[model samples]
Target: MPPVKQQPCPFAPLIFDDEEAIGELSSVVLQLHDALSTNGRCFTTGATEEKAAATRGRIESVLLNAFCTIFGQSPFERFSDIFDQASYLAEHMAKDHIFEDGNKRTSLVFALSILALRNVPVVFPDNPDPKSNPYYAWIQDLVSGKRTREELAQELRSNHISK
Candidate 1:
C-alpha cells in the first residue's frame, strides 16, 4: 500500500513567560504570518511567505519558544527584532499557518500587545464601524498566492508609510 499521508497537527498555541510576556506575546504576530503563509497569503503591514510543509511546524515551535529563546535577557525589548525594518515577521508568521484557526486575529492582538507595552494603543483598521469592514482583504491576496514577502515589504514602505 502507498504510505499514509498524515494530516497537519493544527494545535500549537504559544505560551508567554512572566518576565518576557511582552515580547513573547509579539511572537503570536509572527505566528500569524506563518499561518497566512501556509495558506499562501500576505499582509498590508508587510508580511508574506511561501508555501511549505516544514515551514508551518517550524514557525509554531519557534513562536512557542520565542519567549524562552529570544527574550531570556531582554524582556521589555521592542518589536524590531522580529520585524526588523520591513515588518516581515508578520508575514512570516501568517504564511506558516501554525495554528488550526484564527491565526491572523491572534497575530493582530500580538502586534497590539507590543504597542501596548510601549503605551501605544492599537485598533483594528477594518472594524472601525463594527460592521461591513474590508480590513481583512489583505489576507485574501496572500491566501490566493498573489504576493511575496519582498513584494509586501516594498509595497508597505512605498504606499503604506507616509513620509
Candidate 2:
C-alpha cells in the first residue's frame, strides 16, 4: 500500500528543541514560501526548483536551529519564548538571502503569521505616509542586524493587539 501523506499543522506550539519538531517547523516554512512565491510578490523572475533548494536547506539548518544552543550533552533552548523564536526566524530569512527575491517580504509575513496563529495580531502604528514610517526603518535595522532578536520581540509585543 502507498503511504498516507501527513498534513503539516499550522497551529502547532512553537517548539524547536528537537530534530523531529524542527523538521515539522521547517515544512511549515517551506509551505509558506511556496504560497508566497507565485503570487507576484517577492519571488524572483524565472524562479526554479534549484533556487528553492537553497531556501529549503536554510530552513532545515539555520532557521530551525537559530534559537538552539549547545549544552553539556545536548541542544538546549536559547529563546524559549515564541516571540523570540519568530524574531530569529524572520531575522535569518530576511538577512540570509535564502531566496533570490522577496527576502524581507517573506520573512515579515512568516513572522506575522506565526504570531497571528497565537491570537495576537500586529497593529502597525499609524503613520500618514507609509513609505516614511519608522516601522519600515525598524524592520530594515532588523534585517541589517542592527537590531537584536530580543529587541525585535519586544517591538512585536508592543505592536500587537490581543484578538
Q: Which candidate's TM-score is highest?
A: 2
Tell me the spans in candidate 1 whose CA falls farther than 4 Å from its real position. 1-23, 26-86, 112-124, 128-134, 154-163
Model 1 error, position 35 (Å): 17
Q: Give the alpha carbon lDDT tens digit for every residue of 1-163 in model 1.
A: 9999875222111225554553444444545555655655444333245533344446545444443335454322422232221234445455656555555444434533443443433344556331343324444354456755555434433433221
Which regions of candidate 2 fall more than 4 Å away from where they truly are?
A: 1-13, 17-21, 46-50, 66-76, 125-135
How many clashes in each candidate? 27, 0
| RMSD from true fold, candidate 2 | 8.5
How far off is residue 71 in model 1, in Å? 17
Q: lDDT per model, in order?
A: 0.42, 0.67
Distance from true location, Cα of 148 in model 2, Å: 3.0
- Mind sharing the TM-score for model 1? 0.38
